[model samples]
Structures are given as structure tokens and as C-alpha cells.
Target: MKKLLIVSLGIIVFILLSLPWVLILVGRNKLHDYDIPQREQLIPSSDSKKKVLALFPHPDDEVTVAGTLMRLKEDGHEVVLVCLTRGEKGKSSGIQDEQELARLRTSEMEESARLIGVDQLIISDYPDSGIEDLGMDSLKKVVLNLILEKQPDILISYDSNVGLYGHPDHRLTGKAIEKVFLKEKGKEGFSPDRLFQVTLCKKQVEVALKLSSGFQRNYPENPEMGLPQPDFSVRTQPYFDRILQVMQAHQTQQNVLKDLMPFHDKVPAWIYSRIFDREYFREVK
Candidate 1:
């Protein structure tokens, strides 16, 4: 009985130690699993150039779709990035003063937007982490004015359903964008060809929650909530290296990036591309 117990414990330890490696090996070869037909080009083929505008509550929020934006630039379309806040409330390694931190983050966002080939980068002073407090009408009006000024052919923002992970700021940003889009779309001088909301596959969300305890703790109810399903995915494999550069641009947010995407720097580019080759989005109808 004693020997049997020792063997059982040994087996359990071995399995626990081997699980991650086994998963990695399997993931490296399973790229075909993600090769769905619905994974299509983000920009439709056209002779006329189009302007793409993306809005997010924070500076680093653009990281999720940076590759897609790069792709837009590569395809000869204009890309505009509007960050509603400078991420003044974000975590900083050494900066203690909120104003100084905001400045640093804004600089970082400028570098990131430059790397993504954004033609116009707009940073607003709306309080970070306090977007919802501004009220929906005010938010809608601000978004509407931006849309009117940019006259972008495509509009992008966070999903209205789960806001990618139930963050209140993210949710409010999406809500504000959707409200404006619904109310003013197709109107003269305010028409957008498409409205796409950034989202994650259910499986991607599950993996995120499982990998990062911070994500789980912050969004404890996320698993129980329904997220907007991805209508299509943008193939970003070609821009994977540029995406890494974009992430690296946010030096102050390295800790947050490491927490969320732990394997980004550990694996080779090819391997990382295999896993994160596509950015998912839901076209708001």
C-alpha cells in the first residue's frame, strides 16, 4: 500500500510538470485548426482609398488590433487612432504621479500609433477608468463629432456585449460608439461603410482567464457572461513582427502585457504567429 501511494504521487507530479510542454507542442502543430474560411481580410479590395478610424478607452487598448491597423496601412488605406484617455489610471512601474504617468503613456501611445502607420492619432482628456461617469449622451456626442470630422469609411471599437472582459471603461466605450453609430449612420456627411467591434473568440477568452489570474480576479463574472461572437477574423500573420514592435513601444505597460500575454516573448515569432495569427471582430449591424 505504501509503494502504491508513492507511485501515484510520482505519476501526478509528472503529469503536472509535463502538461504545459505537451500543450505547447500540440499548439505548434494545430495552426490548421484556426484556418477557418471566415478568417478574411479586414479591408475589402477596392480601388478607392478608405479611412479607418478606431476608438478605445486607453492607450494600450489598441494592442489587440494593432496588427489589423498595420495591415490597413499596408493595403494603402488610411488608419486613424483615437484614444479617449491617456490611460492616466494605468499601472506604472516607477511613476507615482498620475499626470506624469499620463504623459509617459501618451508618448508611448504616439510611438505605438506611429509604428502602426496611423495617419492621425488623437488623444483625449476624458478621465481614464471613469468613462461611464461622463453619461451616455455626452459620450455619444463626442464620438459623433469625431466621426463627422474624420469621415472614416470604417469604425472600430470594443464590443458592446462583454467589452472583451467586462471592464467598465471598455464597456462604456463600446456603448458610446454603438449609440453614435446606430443614431447617425447612413446620414448625410456621417455615413460609415462598416462598424466593427473588436472581440475575442470564446475559446480565446477562456484561455485568457485560465492563463492570467489577474484577468480572472478583475472579471470574476466574465465566464458566466456572454460575449459578442466574432463574425470574422483578420489574418495578421504577416504583421506579427510589427505587432511585437507596437507592444514593445508601450514600455511602461510591459508588466501588464506580460501578465496578459505571457508567452509573447518566450516563443519564436513563427510559433507566436501560429497561435495569434488572427484578430477577431464582430460587425455591428
Candidate 2:
């Protein structure tokens, strides 16, 4: 009986030790199930370095594309990030005051941008969770003015359709960028070569909703409503370690991040990167 018990205990320990690797392998296979495009075919080719600008509504919203941004920096492209709100309304364990939370979140974003090697980090004081109140014309004007000042070769933002789970601020940010794109399109010197909207595959949305109640609540009621189909995907495996560091920089938003990526802090970076090796984007026509 003693020998049998020892064997059983050893078996359990072996399983426990092997579980993380098992999960990582499963995740890698599942990701491969998606019909992702070839990177060479989809990524634009340019002889000279280009400027890339990303606009998002809240501080931690940048996390969605952190890896891709880092890859862009490594490719010798100039990357700028514009955050429209400080994410003060976001829930944090110890932070109770909105003003104090705003400051903390702003600093967190600054750290994140630094880690991502962004050339410029622009934080605007638009109301948290109240971007729609700014009105369509007002928001469009703001986005247009930024584009004119930056003259970025590529523009990035959330998908206007479902906002990657129907966050109002996220949707509005995308809308504003779309409006500017429409206004300046075909104008010789004013238009960007492409506008890429960050999006998740249908499988990703399903997985996120299962993992995070926050995502479930923010998602649209209509069953058909979701992000547009991805036009391309960026392979972010090379920058995955830096991506985790960027995420960690947003300390104030750890609760939400943990909910979305439960094993983020627990798993080895190599394992984590295998699971989240790519980010999808839709090109706005």
C-alpha cells in the first residue's frame, strides 16, 4: 500500500509540473486553427522608414497593440500613441478618487509607452467613459487636427463596428478616425497610406467573453454585432517579452489585465508568447 501511495503522489506531481506546457501546446495549436494571412503578403512594403500613429480612448487600451507597435519600432518606423482619456473611471482596488486615479493611470501609460519605445506619447484630457458627449463634429475635428499635425504614414485605432467588445469610448475613437480618413482620402498630401483598426477574431472575442465578465458586460447585445473581419495579422512573437513588460507598466489596471490574461504573471514569457503570437487588424477602405 505504501509503494502504491508513493507512485500515485509522484504521478500527481508530474501532471502538475507538466500542465503549463500542455496548456501552452494546446493554445498554440488552437491559434493555428485560425485562417491567418501570410505576413509577407499583407504587410506593406516601403523603401524608406514610415511614421505610424495609434489613437485609442483610454490608457490601457494601448495594450491591445503593444506587441505590434514594438515590432514597428524595431522595423525602424516612427510610432506615436495618442490616448484620448486617462482611464480615471476604471476600477482599481485601492484608488477611490477619480482625480488621483487619473494621475496614476496617466503615469502608468507613460511607463508603458516608454517600454514600447514609442517616439511620442500624447495624452489628452477627454472625459473617461464620456467620449460620445464630445459630439461627432467636435471629435472629428480633434482627430483631423492631430492627423494634420502628425502626417503619419499609417493610422491605427479600434474597430468602429463593435469596438472590440462595444466600449463606447473605443467606438467613438474609431469613428472619429474614420471620419477623418473619409474627409482626407484622395487628397494628395493629406491622406495616410492606410488606416488599420485593431480587432479580434471571432474566436478571440468568444474566448475573451468567457474569460472576463468585464468584456461580457461591455459587448453588444446583438448577437450578430462584433468586430469586422481582420484584413491582416502581425506576428508579434519577437516582441512578446517587451509586450509583457508594457502590460506590467500599467500597474493600476492589473485587475482588469489579470481577468483578460489570467496566466500572464504565472507563465514563462516563452509560453505566453506562443499563445499570443499575433495581433489582428482590419484595413479601412
The lDDT values for all models are 0.82, 0.84
Candidate 2 matches the true fold with a TM-score of 0.88
Cand. 1 Cα-lDDT: 0.82
Off by over 4 Å in 1: 1-25, 28-40, 92-94, 220-224
lDDT of 2 by residue, 11-87 (tens): 99999999988988898665543676736222455646788889999998888888888877877889989999999
How displaced is residue 112 in candidate 1, in Å? 0.3
Poorest 10 consecutive residues by lDDT, candidate 2: 38-47
Residue 183 shift from truth in candidate 1, angstroms: 1.7
- Model 1 lDDT per residue over 1-285, tens place: 999999999999999888766765676344333443445468776647888899999988899898888878888898889999988788657777899999999999999998888999999999998988899889898899999888899999997766777778888889889988887778889868689998877667667777876567565474556567777788888888888988999998888787656678988776677567788888988
Residue 121, candidate 1: alpha-carbon lDDT: 97
Kindly give the number of clashing pairs for every candidate.
Answer: 0, 0
**Count of backbone collisions in candidate 1:** 0
